[model samples]
Target: MSPAFRWFHQDVSSRYTGLLCLFAGLLLPFAFAPVGIGLLAVPLLAWLFFAWSDASPRQAFRYGFLFGLGQFTAGVYWIYHSLYEFGHIPTPVSMLLVVVLAAGLALYPAAAGYLANRISLSAPSMRLLAIYPASWLLMEWLRGFVLTGFPWLNLGASQTDTLLAGWMPVVGEYGVTLLLGVSAGALVSLFRFRSGYRWPVAVTLLSALWISGWVLQQQNWTETSASLSVSLVQGNTPQELKWDPDARTKILNSYLILSEEVWKRDLVIWPETAIPAFAQDIEKFTQGLSGLTKLTGSDLITGIPMVEKGRYYNAIITLGSESGRYYKRHLVPFGEYIPLGSAFGSLLDLLHVPMSDFSTGRLDQPPLKVAGQLAGLSICYEIAFSSVIRAQLPQAGFLVNLSNNAWFGDSIAPHQILQLSRVRAMETGRAVLSSTNDGITAVVDHRGQIQAQAPQFIGTVLNAEVLVQTGATPFVRWGEWPVIIFAILLLVAGFVRSCYQENQPEEKTRG
Candidate 1:
């Protein structure tokens, strides 16, 4: 075997091997936003594929789970900060929650590793190139969908700032995952066959993909129609003070006072729950504000909780141009609405968050018309769902993402979310207006590049012009169907080949 492939012979059950896998996973998050070194994912995943080589299903599961546990434990440790510092959970219980969540997420990778090895072909080329990538993406797809999903820390997220990001408008994030997996598999093949004829071929193919991405990045999938001047208000209200009765008026006044200067602009936006009061409770105030904006021909959009028919909803309302509203559909688990609320009702009492039972919005709500452009609204966590973003389509000229990230403090969660919002802009070929309470309030162009931004932990307003994009990218049209179908086919083919190989050896032994 080539020296490059020698690692494949290492004992999977060895203590040192497990440690190395854990370390690899720990290093994975640095590849994502706020520390954007995307190339690290290639070698890390290659190492994982090598460790899985020649391992039993059980051994593969253990190695994969360890990697996942380490990955989540490091990547999303911010959850502990939110739960304890913000949710008011005890320190020990918060730590325990993090551990349990990490362990649960680890099972996806464990299942993927088990299935990969169980159905792997004997040929090194086929096993690493086809089977491994397919299995990995299948797990990623499943992870994104199962139990309302928590698609954080996806491998493709690391590629957001790299050349691979260009593939987003064409195939969306999952398609980018498939491309990334193929690159990792190629890296493994290149190393495993260093002395064979295929190593050079792998090198050529890898270079082609990277170069193709760069070329794709140069093309414009969506056309810029008109530009609308906008102002995004960042209240920067502390989470502790947000729900306090005395602070409610202060928060509303702060946003209004900030907008007083920029109300002449085509559109003005506020962060999620900027009002900190129910829509009906503030009806007279909203109506007066709406009249003022109408007189000035300015459209004002702000986040506020709404109580109608005795059901509360987390929603955004537009008060000018063409009046409309968008209620958030994909509510945050526990934060917005508790999942399995009946069973977890007692547990939710321990959480300090307010209005934790907001009802989901209708799936078919139309985009709000702001300054003659259709604006798709995503309140906080809803931006993480690509399908929900894509559903707006070519009709919604640009996207407006309103969020209150103060709950996560200064952790990487907010930065990671900003990164995801950028990807969403790229995927749909629309400029994104990402307005937040505490930071990262920015204007992203159609290409997913940040044009302007506000600093975190400050009360400020971001002023910029976003282009109305008209054409649709391939991703906006097809969504994840193509890549998903391709992954399923690859998995089936890999297992069929493995079955044939298993039978051939038995026939020869019988002869």
Candidate 2:
């Protein structure tokens, strides 16, 4: 072939590579909730690694960004329903914001690809097996907390239904993410090196990882303390009705009517903002509910907004024998409060979101003492951040996440939250009770199995008995630092090797 023809062919191949990267990202969400074919995860990520391998640093960055753009756009597109349908924003603007958010998130993966290529390792096998995967894990961890974080759709969450979830109790979600990336990297390595030792090593590593996960899964890290009967009430209140002042009475009645039968149970849960009014504004009404709880010998946990002095907080308050109040720690940026400063504060006004400017609860607050055990508390978006839930572990007997999914309308957002809660359960060795305002009101046992669930768009109650766990998983004891530090060390070691290569004398060449 002529030199010009070869150049044209290479350029065309690169363009096709870019398109394939975007296609991988678009289909990635099927590996997650609602659809939940986690078997697709390894193949999808394998394609991404393969695409990144042959690209220059700049081309790799673009490919990685497009991949992330596609993944995030599909994974969290339900935000459009909240923004346009509930926030009352114009359709075009709502979609534009979603696009812009996806674009911003894309930068994390772009940085991963750039760093991986810029610090490319000398050994082909090492680069394919370790360097690419470490870069991906580091970026994934960064995405969870920087600028108030949106850790939605984490790769490990997809593994909740897969055998790899057995690794969650040992390594936590991020560790599982690293393992998943490594699995993807192994695929790329297997194809790149077809001879001798490297192929055998790749096969051994893949088989060992999966076999260990299966083995680790049979070992129970936590033991049952007591079996407690719990009921989760699904009010199914429409987002419009919950926020409207005139409909507060109807919404309040719906919950009250639903709970009347379950008050005899040990603990009854109401979804986020189930009261739909400030606690101070309904002091007497709250006392009546408190009285009812005392009468039935039960503890009732309900989401309500509270005010103290001048600050507002989204809180879960318990009434009856073991009473306590736990406020939400992490709040969603636009949905809960405005970030940065006053310039963005007007979004609440334009969007007309009720009780949107909530002050964040102190991170030091202890788990709530309710029912017969200490219950770790998370409100809505808080469950998305594994670290937030991790902080309360070993001490709290179980977990409870109060959510109002009505704002998301008929979208995968509801199911995704449930997926995150399952990951949280396995990581902490505690059963997670997910109580939502609409659909997916269910119970996830400590092993991350769904015990039972109520269908969405219905006013009902789900009753199940769960064992309160008494011990912590390895993930809870050591946290995510081990995996993160491992990734950091890999990059640092690569940098040192590159420096050594640069400092070495070049061999003399004959003229």
Candidate 3:
């Protein structure tokens, strides 16, 4: 029997494989923040390749689904917190929604496993190095775009603190995912390579990826244009009172009072829906804000719902110096705009969500002019999409992300979004001013480092001098196409090779 054949193609499946996958899935969250052992993503993913090495297509599917179940189960538990604690959804329904969302996402991993086995690759290196990662990346890419996408918890986001982040400017997050997948495949090769230079090759692959990332990190993709002094307001408005009529004037007064002393800064940011009412409803107040910002030479950008011809929008408006307005283009399903509302009419009536029907702004909305600079704007959930940030780039000197994560309330979701906004900063080669209601108001520099941040659940202002940058990273110029296309080509090569092996019945007696 050939050593390569025996190493990869085997009947050595174990009884504990299911639990192994389940626990390995559990390891997925630990690889990301709150417990940010970033490199753990390697060993965490290695378990999947290791388990699928000797399983049938059906077994591989089951194992993959279990791995995904474990992953989202741990990763997205905050959905329940957002729905029940803040949305005031019933406990039973909230729990069911969480389970359903996780199960739906699990299908991607399950498909990855089924395809890996269905495509025959007897040669150990080819199977582990090519077919495996490519299959995984393609499935994940699909998961990111389908149904307006939930690109959260993508493996690439977990690599922000790693050397792999150096590659982010050039290839974006999914590219990092592809590279990370290769790293996981190499890890499995280390254990199964048996004898010869395959072990050294696997080591070399990992080292090259790490070294390249570090080397890339040292290169300056964007040049500093100027330093802009900024202040972020953490209103600490409880989600329960955020939309309350009695609390409306008090909330507005609290934010205005907090900014009283800090308006001299170049830019002042407020969290999503900080106004807590329609712009027309508070026209007199907005006019006064415009006058105040102009008097202080500060550009104030805040989230205030705008009503235009009777359509509602979750929008960001700039006042003073040069003004610009951007309505959120990517709306969160059910939260921002319900999907198939009529189909789930009964359920919707029960949930009674607010700001749930926001109309999306134009896709080509230009960046807002603020503080003598142009900045990209993303409202709450919109920051998760790279397109929302990139569309404003080459024109935008910095990025502004406004969110109301009080709904998440002390969950890792707030931290997770903070992490993601930083990734956008890295990808676009632009500074990011991400302000959230209550906590995690932070300023991230062009290199994706946090310059300053406010403490969670505080009604205080976080002030910092942020660098405004010029020029675009490769990611801004070219989106995820390079990585997506590369994955597609790799899968094609694997399929063709698998087909050749099938037609060659007389070729080998390996194993």
**Model 3, span 341-448: residue lDDT tens:** 778656555666777877888999988788888888889888888877888888999999999998787889988998898789889888889898987898988899
Each candidate's lDDT (Cα)?
Answer: 0.86, 0.87, 0.87
Q: What is candidate 3's local distance difference test score?
A: 0.87
What tens digits encode model 2's per-residue C-alpha lDDT throughout 382-406?
9988788988888999999999888
Q: Select the stronger candidate by lDDT from 1 and 3.
A: 3
- Residue 345: error of model 2 in Å? 2.0
Model 1 over residues 45-144: C-alpha lDDT tens digits? 8778777776788988988898899889988898898899877889999999998998899888888889999985767777777788788888988988
Highest-scoring model, TM-score = 1
Model 1 lDDT on a 0 to 1 scale: 0.86
| TM-scores for candidates 1 onward, in order | 0.97, 0.96, 0.96
Misplaced by over 4 Å in model 1 are: 7-15, 507-511
The residue ranges of model 2 lying beyond 4 angstroms of the native Cα positions read 1-12, 505-511
**Models ranked on TM-score:** 1, 2, 3
Name the runs in model 3 displaced over 4 angstroms: 1-12, 506-511
lDDT of 2 at 243: 76
Instruction: Please give me the total number of clashing residue pairs in predicted model 3.
Output: 0
